[model samples]
Target chain A: AQSVTQPDIHITVSEGASLELRCNYSYGATPYLFWYVQSPGQGLQLLLKYFSGDTLVQGIKGFEAEFKRSQSSFNLRKPSVHWSDAAEYFCAVGGGGFGNEKLTFGTGTRLTIIP
Target chain B: EAGVAQSPRYKIIEKRQSVAFWCNPISGHATLYWYQQILGQGPKLLIQFQNNGVVDDSQLPKDRFSAERLKGVDSTLKIQPAKLEDSAVYLCASSRAGGQADTQYFGPGTRLTVL
Candidate 1:
């Protein structure tokens, strides 16, 4: 079984400040990790994903995540965040094919942007 | 490309009532997923489908929950005798099938509130 853990339950950051959300995963083989964001009433949007090569991966809306195999972590980072960035963020892991893959998601971290 | 689509954006019902959610995946996507997101928790996978066939439903409470994908393109999830604990956002997601690079795209989700 695969699982994801997000240490922070809630995070608050001032507008224009840098942001980082921690994520750790437990999987036997090489894992595929992803970051997703959800607005108040909208579905989740993919922030980024890491499958193979290049530990650092970039995503939409000025977000990036680095996959650290040694640490078993894939943390999301942004140089600056906008008020719109305030939302619930989730970390997920899967270890199979597209049609056959099963995902295990973290409990999620609620992000608040202080204006 | 159009994103995943879900119906009845919101639903309010009393305990023991029944409710159903519908989802339309992307045009060529061969995999579909159903998830539940509580108020402060991350989305949990309830079921996964591969072209009209179920791949996983281990986490689903079969006693009250049922889902089906008739043609592999669209899916429906039903909850019979809903409970207050069933109040959450039901989300539908889709991805291209075959290999490990299945990046899921989520729908806006249907918010179900049990009174």
Candidate 2:
């Protein structure tokens, strides 16, 4: 079974401040990680994904995540968060294929930005 | 390209009532997925379809929940005699089904509220 853990349930940050959302996972094999964002009344939008390349990968909307194999973590980070960036973020883990392509998602972290 | 599309952005129903939601995946996407997301929890995979065939339905409640992608393009999920626990956001997502790690595009999701 695969699972993702997001330690932060809710986080508040001021505009222009750096932000980091922690995500840890438990998987037997090399995990494929992803970050997704969901606004209040919208569906999730893909932020980035890590398969089997560089440890760090850049994503849309000025977001990036580093896959730390040893720590079983793929935390999303941004140099600064804009007001529009505030949304619920989720981290997910899955296998490449081999009849195990379904994804297991985290509880998600709700981000709030203040002026 | 247009993203995944789901109908009935919001629905309110009484307990034990029946409800159904529809989804249309991105063009050329062969893999479609349905997920259930509670208010404060992450989205849980309920079913997965690979071009009109069922790939996985382990988490879906077979007794009350049923879904079908008859044409492998548009899909529908139905809940008969719905329960209070079933009140949540139903998300539809699709991927290219490349036999490898692929990003799943999501729909706006249908919010179901059972009274």
Candidate 3:
């Protein structure tokens, strides 16, 4: 079964500071990875996705994630975090088949930005 | 274009009561999904539909939970005899099924509380 793991439960960073959120996955084959963000009382928004080609994939909101197959990791990063970036972040894996289109998500990482 | 639409942003009911949530996917989306998210956890796939057909429902509890996407446009999720542990956020998502890459758009979730 495909699964994802997020080590950080919560993280705090000052405005304009660099940020990184860790994610790891377990799957037999190459996994399709994704990162999503959710604000309070809102639906999750896609941040980035990794399919095959590039190891590093850029996303909206100045965010990016690197898919490291060796370590089974797909960590999200931002050069600087804005106050508006405070939200919950999730990592997910897909790519089994049509019946397996459902993503396997990791426990989310709650991000808090400090002024 | 409007994103996925979900009704009843919040719901509170006593244990053993029945409740239903609705979702309208983005126009032309062939695939729809329902997920359950517990507090501080990632969303779990409850069911998946592709053009009104059940693509996958392995995780859904058939005894008390049921869902359908009639005519391949809108969908509904129902839970009978809800348990206290079922108090969580129910999320809906949509995507273009049969694509090489599975990209899903999410809807604002329905927060459920069982007292």
Candidate 4:
């Protein structure tokens, strides 16, 4: 089974400060990792994805993530966060499981940005 | 391209009442998924369909929940005798189902409040 764990339930960061959200996954084989953001009353939007080649992947909204196989982590990072960046972020792992397109998601981390 | 679409963005129903939610995937998307997201939790897969065929439905509660994608384009999820625990956001997502890392686009989600 593929599962994701997000240790931080809530995080508060000041505007213009750097941010990092931790994510850990358990899967038997190589896993497909994804970062998604959800604002109030909106659906989730894909920020980035990591499949095979690169350990570091860039995503929309000036965000980036690095896949560390040794640690079984794919952490999302941003050089600076804006007030509008306040939202819930989720990490998901898919593939290499019972079903082809099934995804296992983490509990999510709610981000709060203050000026 | 337009993103996934869902109907009845908000619903308030009493316990033991029935409610249904609808979803329409992107034009060419072959895979559709229904997920239940409880407050402060991540979205959990309830069911999945691939071109009108069931791909995975391991987590769906068969006793109270039922879903169908009759023509493989539009889908519906229904809950009979709703419970207080059923109050959550029902998210619908779709993917092209092309490869290992296919990204799933999400709808705005229908927030159900069980009174």
Give lDDT: candidate 4, residue B12: 99
**Candidate 1, residue B2: CA error in Å?**
1.9
Rate residue A41 of model 2 by lDDT: 89
> DockQ score of candidate 2?
0.72
lDDT tens digits by residue: candidate 1, A4-102? 999999999999999999999999999999999988889999899999999999999999999999999999999999999999999999886545677
Give i-RMS (Å) per prediction: 1.8, 1.6, 1.6, 2.2
Q: Which candidate is the best by DockQ?
A: 2
The residue ranges of model 1 lying beyond 4 angstroms of the native Cα positions read none
lDDT string, candidate 4, A50-113, tens digits: 9889899999999999999999999999999999999999999988544466788999999999
Q: Which lDDT values do the candidates have, in the order given?
A: 0.92, 0.94, 0.93, 0.94
What does candidate 4's lDDT look like per residue over B1-115, in tens digits? 9899999999999999999999999999999999999999999999999889988899999999999998889999999989999999999999897356678999999999999
Displacement of the residue B94 alpha carbon in candidate 4, Å: 0.6
Query: RMSD in Å for candidate 1, one decimal?
Result: 1.4
By lDDT, the best candidate is: 4
lDDT string, candidate 1, B3-68, tens digits: 899998999999999999999999999989999988878888899988888988989999999999
DockQ of each: 0.71, 0.72, 0.70, 0.67
Per-model TM-score versus the true fold: 0.95, 0.97, 0.98, 0.97
- State the lDDT at B46 in candidate 1: 96
lDDT for B42 (candidate 3): 95
The sequence of per-residue lDDT tens digits that candidate 3 reaches over residues A1-115 is 8899999999999999999999999999988899999999999999999989999999999999999999999999999999999999999998767556769999999999999
Off-target runs (Cα >4 Å) in candidate 2 are: none
State in Å the error of residue B99, model 4. Answer: 3.5
| lDDT accuracy of residue B33 in candidate 3 | 93
